[model samples]
Target: MALEDVSLHIEPEDIYGIIGMSGAGKSTLIRCINLLEKPVAGEILIDGNCIFRKFGKFFENNNEPELMLQGAELRNLRRQIGMIFQSHNLLMQKTVSQNIAFPMEIAGAPKHEIDKRVSELLEVVNLADKVANYPSQLSGGQRQRVSIARAMANMPKILLCDEPTSALDSLTTNQILDLLWDLNQDYKVTIVMITHEIELVKRICNKVAVIDRTRVVDQGEIGQVLLNPSMEITKQLLSGSRGTRG
Candidate 1:
């Protein structure tokens, strides 16, 4: 239900991944990173700055902390981190460009700057032609691409993605993966992808952390924990694919 003592170090420009079985608290960790789901304890740091310092140290019966980011501090810190969900939480009523512009508008960016960034992101995502389109008018993969564009609108240093590829078919999954990989290379953004699929990690992530029972059981380079897996869950994750390959 909650992550416990999970500490992860995602290198800059690395495609880091978090994987586990359902109810393993991986999602909770992702939510915590973005401050979407407040934690009772521990602090989230981005590039040596404590973006959110939560204080539920002992998991008391509904007691709260005295200090953490608030108002402008919280809002400013949140701007540095961007999040996308598996469901592609886009504004159905807005056009693709408008959806990507939502965050900038909220931040009070000038209309000219918003127009410039929206145009740039559309090209980066290869959805320039779909700028006038709505979420309902695009394919699943296209919709996710738009979401990725939106997530990068502010040029965040870190991107938090929760099962962004879970809704796509195999071919489209790879396409989205390629786009993410390109984003990492081009923008030098650190990407943290959360998923249940081991193959997804193997294919894209250079580093990974495995979560189980609200705790991180394994974490390291892909070759270590994933390729030559040491933990039971890691072995189990590789088992099906290994079996298939064998």
Candidate 2:
């Protein structure tokens, strides 16, 4: 794979959006942040720690032994970051509450604590009554809501959304965006979303980045970048409006 240079700083409480075409490398950029795709060059910093550059070598071997992490440090880092995907990735056999509670269970939260957290999450996503319903019973939008609840189960400081609204209809997309905005306001969680939706960027994103050919072409405040797009590719994307809308 060819190397691409990209850089951006997302502050806490900011809704950062990355827009691009299907092969524009949006997915690769997000994966690089979590060290899921190791970049041959460049640095990825999370909360001031250079996690990628510092630990890049650790991922060299797919079968590398898992090193014991100091309990508090590992817990703190993992609990502070959350991720949600377009697929909803819910357990078909599990109930809504159970799916939302899965992460907390993995982290070894007490039973009472898990229950309370799940209740709060369901309320946040407006799925309080569907707690007992399974994924098979919920609509695409509802399923995405459940995924959001699960992602936020640990009250993460940073939330990564990879084409989160791609499978939903317009109405549901708006609802989900509103929910995310609400979360940003209520919890001050920094949201980094990867999508091909120009409308979505105009609607909720305060900061926007345009990626093309495995590199970021332009990025800035939404209003400024949209008004005076610095890159030709960005102007083309905006003009054609061929990107993903949902």
Candidate 3:
């Protein structure tokens, strides 16, 4: 029960950021959206579908069972949504190409198609030359780029990033943010990023939600909150946020 009464909307083609302190249920909220962390109540609707809403006795038919997605149905839905972690969860033993192609391979894509898509994704993430390289051979930033490519391998409608750039330095973080922006523009993928850095939000996010103590204290267009913060936590976060974004 990390989150309580937390709600937010993310539009298509959005790079939405969820900003908060370390223990503010930021990860829990994002995980709930993907069904990683299930909430006891509340409906999480994506594309107007309530993924978490229970059925059975709660549905219109009293005798019918819960209309929950399971097996292939759930897998198919998950395929349409991609998620990346704070750590580069690459296959250490597999080459970069193989890691990027892992999901497509699992979904039974053809060898030729996997190869072709891997090549295209590598190019997109600017890692074409490192196709044969393993995760151990790449730098932190390069590994993150490869993870991003893998996340997009399925051409998902939504991409969930959990502290995508927290491990990198300021320069590399900026680079990764720029890459995310490029992906959002090119693929029209809706992005939901979880982060503790407000500067990161100002740099990339269009809409944002600030969470604290399992609750969302403030949220709206990034411009509004950044320019004029209202809540005490929001003001504190903004005050500590470094740099002056243009």
> Which candidate tops TM-score?
3
In order of lDDT, best first, we have: 3, 1, 2
Taking all chains together, each candidate's TM-score versus the true structure is 0.91, 0.88, 0.92
Query: In lDDT terms, how accurate is model 1?
Result: 0.86
Give lDDT tens digits, candidate 1, residues 173-206. Answer: 9999999999899999899999988889988999
Per-candidate local distance difference test: 0.86, 0.84, 0.87
Location of the lowest summed lDDT over 10 successive residues in candidate 1:
57-66
What is the total number of backbone clashes in candidate 1? 2
Better of 2 and 3 by TM-score: 3
In terms of TM-score, how similar is model 1 to the real structure? Answer: 0.91
Clashing pairs in 3: none
Worst 10 residues of 2 by lDDT: 61-70
Question: Which stretches in model 3 have alpha-carbon errors above 4 Å?
Answer: 55-67, 241-246
> Which of candidates 2 and 3 is the stronger one according to lDDT?
3
